[model samples]
Target: MWIAESVTFGGSALDRAAPLRGDAPALADLQARGRIVPLWQGKPLIANGALAWVAPGSPVLAEATAPVFLGLEDGIGWFAQDISAWVPPEAEAVQPGFLDPSLQHHPSLPADHTFTELRAVMAQLSPRHAELAATARALLGWHQSHGFCAACGAASTMVMAGWQRSCPVCGAQHYPRTDPVVIMLVTRGNRLLLGRGTGWPEGMYSCLAGFVEPGETIEAAVRREVFEETGVQVDAVRYLASQPWPFPASLMLGCLAEATSDTITLDPAELEDALWLSREDLVQVRTGLHPCVKPARQGAIAHFLIENWLADRLN
Candidate 1:
């Protein structure tokens, strides 16, 4: 909680410049000196541990069709484009993966440039890069998924500089929506509760999380999720930090809670297993000495909470 803003995808604030998003003339003027960040297949170009954030008139922007205005910084406009639809030129065939030794160049940019998955290189990026990448992914993914108006089933047009979609026939407007998920750090005495989803990687465990239902509060959601996932009743829920998890769109509301009772009830449909890990157990996992139950990976709120708990920083 003390290091709340240090969480990967939530704390960093990207100036959206919402009003300017609707100003075509102002946007165009800014475009003359603005920078564009292109996303291909949900990944961004990373050169020397930074986003390309190409300047106006770059080859990348020239090839991009109808980019979304991201926001502004220092009077310079920022925009984003999803070029996943663009077909790449021919290249030497190789295995497709980050592990492949050879570099994969951008289809439009120079041969030295390459695109990498944000998650794979997020830790290497600055706080701003992570924030912008999350913003772009969420906005673009929303556009990709919501192509029609839910109210009238009419085709929608991108408007508000990518902040909204409008259906001309119905006069309906749709904005990007983020689903709220409650992730709790439930503790009883010196032990913390962690659960592994049914399909999670072996040895991987994290805090209990579930989407907040309609008409539910964050505190209630945390209590309900912890109880439903592991049959552990918790009370006195307190907010911690949050993260923007845009693997299609989610806002993780991290919280800390006090368990009223310790009881294990496996929701087979929700979790593969649930267990209580003490500080020593967590230390072993952190040290890679535990036989199973690896700590949540860095950059995740679960890991952030656990690390802070270990350091007596969570308040």
Candidate 2:
């Protein structure tokens, strides 16, 4: 597990500067000198394959929400802001699909910079930018969806430099939430277990995964998820690596599990299809030679784990 943090969004080594979260004067100073990444409807602004950073007073942030302090790099503060309030002039450019390919441009921003889906450009960004973008997206999305306090049912205001929400009615406080999910590489002999979720892209398959329930351990979640989806009983489960998947907010716990049973009792409610593939078959799929199966998206933990397994680097 030494390579665990080498996964995308985990090894930035950015100093979060947590102590400054509660200091108004210190935060204000950082805000004045720090660069900000603006996100539109969850998509970060990218320019030439890198995160597009602008000054705190940039005109593009006219309708932006309060900035969230991401961290520090080389003694410079990094922040992210949500400009979801601004409407794109050409709404039609925004497509509706599993992954939106459309990009949005603001009149005040550089013509070369556009708001693009993080997934589409995640692999292209440097580790530091990728971590910053992921943190920003997750934090901003949390603020948007958790505006109301759970305890008092009252609207909450952003506090702690956007790391928390405070309710004025009941004085309740809430922090950003990250759900834990187990994505396992379940193998029996030389074959791997893969499942396709309903409505996923045709032929797309990935490691079986499920959310870790309350009071459940990661190992237990991996075993239960594989059994529930493919009727495969997992015997030995071991941690592999992890990724911060902020498509809303999820921390993907990647693991390798040895399967004790191979009989697939398809759970249609959980998967559209489930099957086993030998290491050789995975080689074909990886190289795009498989006739009916597509490998998981690159940069995802599933793909990373599978690649390492193929190269015999899992040890």
Candidate 3:
């Protein structure tokens, strides 16, 4: 299929400036002049259908800030503030926050807003906002989950501008973890294969995917996932694209595999159903006329692959 050069969070203009993450003095200065994006329990601040970035002088930054130093953009530093402790009484928690932030008190702020979901607003956000939000969410999630050292069971402190966690007692340095997942667009002649899990909404089918094994290559992962889930043999697998899916941190490896067998043996434990659809069937589905399958949502690599397959753009 066609390679998507610009996945949701892949194409961005921010200069990460990895070396500067270790500069404490520089980081502090950045916090003073840089803009702040509040993440309530890891959900980015959203307003007017986009991410809400707070200025350095904003009351929220000065009063309730627990800022995690994000990278720079256009030479201007950026940070994300964890304000989960200050959620309003009547407001409900959003669906996609990375993990719980232990907040003590509510801060003075406006009564209402549009939304606070990162995935929900990703497609509508600017590339800058999307990249920053994804970075903040993944970084904060790592800190929340890795607060203690695995080696010596010691508490770890945040370091490297929220990029690394260091254990105080063990002196162990830990970095953020990202899981790799192989998402395949398997095709046989003019048809493509799609699978739906047990709990998914009815008629919603997308690419077959599974996590990468310890010793397996991306190509091996693609073939293994397809057979394990659907019992369909595959060959001629080639990589297409990659996407960073930060719902608790996963790197999606998108690939295209040509199925050698037309018959499918369904694995009920792994998939509720798996089937082949022709190019015409995809056209109907994309146009909202197909009855058996609903197209994948926008901004997802699955959607990107399917759209490209229909247009014969998989070069």
Candidate 4:
């Protein structure tokens, strides 16, 4: 994995200013002076900005529509609000401040939000910006979806900044969780395997992927998923790369697997079609010649992995 960090959402060595989380006064002072952007779901709950490690008065206390805080891994805090508090069209305008260049507007709720499917804006984001955007989007997404404690079914309160939630009644600590998924490009000699899920539009077939079970390893997950979905037995699953898919908080683990057997027993429930495509057919699909299927999304880890594999750049 020499290019592990080269993958999308790979972290930038930002100085998160960890020591300041506990210093209320210093934190307050810094917030006042940092660059601020208003984030609104239904109502503008909070904003994020860059605070000089020394300044004061980001003045977030008064605008405090809600009390949730977002904690960066390095300890810089992002005070947050449950965007669900706001209604739909309004929630779309959340401005989280200083769009750190990730992918097109960091694919946030703001105008800058980028999506792998939205290619026009994708290039606007610098590689580092895309990484940070993915990170922020992922964190915010987790916060939005996991407001209730899983343990006692109680409404959880934000704690430990925004990095965790605590059950007020039972004291259960719920941290942000990233689901593990394995997406692999299965290959047999010069041919590759791609399949489309039941609801996918026409001819689009990307990689075979599934969630990694609680007891399974990444490699095992890759093999199991390929077999279960298309009856393609895979061996020697080699790790390729990973990415942070914030659609709902998932860590997509990418790999390359060799198909030992390919009979195409299509799982009616899992996929609508499966195929062994030669390099030539793949080119047609990529260029939109193959009318039945669409290509893997750009800016997506699946697309990147496949593109690189085709170009022989994975090494």
Candidate 5:
């Protein structure tokens, strides 16, 4: 739970500039001060002051760019040019290209200027330095994806300090969307139930999860998804932890469930297979010695939940 705050959207100490959300006068001041930076598709930071990711005159990668307002919600102003007309990410660009040293992306290109995605950059920066970066990255990403009106086909424009979008045609208003998905660590005494999808990397297995439907509750979604995918009945579902997955936007709700039955009748359509394994067996998978099963990646909530569960931290 301690790392929960460090998880996506949990609060990485980003300077959200919340005070400027509505104060028009202040937003204008920042625009004049030129403190704002551009975030590509709401992910990558381009430049601010002397700190820049894209080199001057480098083929303006239009495909990944979006103009975003950075500062408080009261009066944030847009500084970057609108580049939403561009298509998908450039094939040659690294995903989070800012992290690639070969490309020489910098979190603090200029000592006076700051950057976003601080959590990821924190490995090399102070917590305060990383916090501001995280704030900018998450907010910009939200604005980029929510550019279209969900209620109408009209194109929505950024408003409310980059927190709200207004449809041009029908007058519909939209906000950033955060979808909920339940990930369960099902336990039967000393053993844990882990599963693998058909297309997942070989040897990797993790918790079962699914989106919560409009009418169903979080706990019900966990139970229903588990039964539907692997025919394993679960009971005593308990909230454990949660994480934000910004790939398009989703909130992963981690939970613990007690398995009432051990036999796995996998719905092959949903998973390649599933089985109950003891802690000792899991250790092999974690260490890469298990012949058939591999553990989930380190940064994923699935891995975090499992590690904490194994350490009895969820209690």
Candidate 6:
């Protein structure tokens, strides 16, 4: 796991600048000279295969919500603003699917610069840009969903540079929440356990994954998820790498586990199908030559784990 940090969305060494979160003067100064990443409906604006940054007073940001201070690099500040309120002249109806392939364009931005889904271009972005996009998406999504205080029914106000929300009625402060999920690469000798959820694309299968329940350790979560999903008993679970999955804010904890039992008793509610693939079969899947299985998403931790396992780098 020496190369663990190299996983997508995990390796940007961006300086978060925690202390400056509460300093109004400092943040104001940074905002005046910083670059901003505009997001629409959770999609970051992209141009030339990278994050397209705009100035603070860009016309595209006229309808933007409060900006979140992302951090600084090379003495220049980076921020993210949500312009989800702006309606496109001819907005495409929102598609009901896992990943939205539609792109949005603001009149102020160049024609080449479009608001794109992060998953569609995550692999193409540099480490720094990927990290920034993930952070902004997750934080903004949290704000949208958690507008009301949990402790009280009163609405909350953004504070701490978009990192926290304060409830005036109850004097309660809430921070962005990230749920932990364990995605395991369960192996028995030369075969790996794979499962396909309901509604997944045909021929698509990936490492079994589930959320870490309350009071459960990472090891326990891995074992439980594998057993619950496929009736496979796992032992000797070890940490692999992690990915920040921001579909709605999840920290995917990747793990490698040895399967003691190969029998699959599928939970109809959890998975549509479960099976094991030998290393040779997996190789074919990765290369798009397998008849029954498609490769995992390229920028996902499942793909990272499988690629490393194929190369015998899972030590």
Winning candidate number (TM-score): 6
lDDT of 6 by residue, 223-284 (tens): 99898888899999999889999998999999999999999999999999999999999989
The collision pairs in model 6 are: none
**Prediction RMSDs, each to the true structure:** 2.7, 1.0, 3.5, 6.7, 5.9, 0.9
lDDT of 1 by residue, 167-203 (tens): 9999999999999999888999999999998667789
- For candidate 4, write residues 1-315 as lDDT tens digits: 576666655645544455665566765654554422223222221112211111123332233233333334344444433223323343344344323222212222444222222122333455544544444555556766788989889898765445668899998898889899999989998889988877665566788889999989999999888888899899898888888776657889999899899788888888888899888777887888876667876667877887787778876
Model 5 residue 28 CA deviation (Å) reads 3.9
- Candidate 3 global lDDT: 0.80
TM per prediction: 0.91, 0.98, 0.90, 0.75, 0.73, 0.98
lDDT of 4 at 7: 61
Q: Model 6 clash tally? A: 0
For 99-196, candidate 5 gives per-residue lDDT tens digits of 33212233324443322333243334333323334445556667655677788776788776666788889998887777899999999999999898
The C-alpha lDDT values of all candidates are: 0.82, 0.91, 0.80, 0.62, 0.64, 0.93
Better lDDT candidate (2, 4) = 2
What TM-score number comes out for model 4?
Answer: 0.75
Local accuracy of candidate 2 as per-residue lDDT tens digits, 157-253: 9999999999999999899999999999999999999999999998899999999999999999998888888888999999999999998999999
Model 2, runs deviating above 4 Å: 91-93
Q: Per-residue lDDT for 233 in model 2?
A: 92
Give candidate 5 regions above 4 Å deviation.
1-3, 6-15, 31-66, 69-146
TM-score of 1: 0.91
- Lowest summed-lDDT stretch of 10 residues in model 1? 92-101
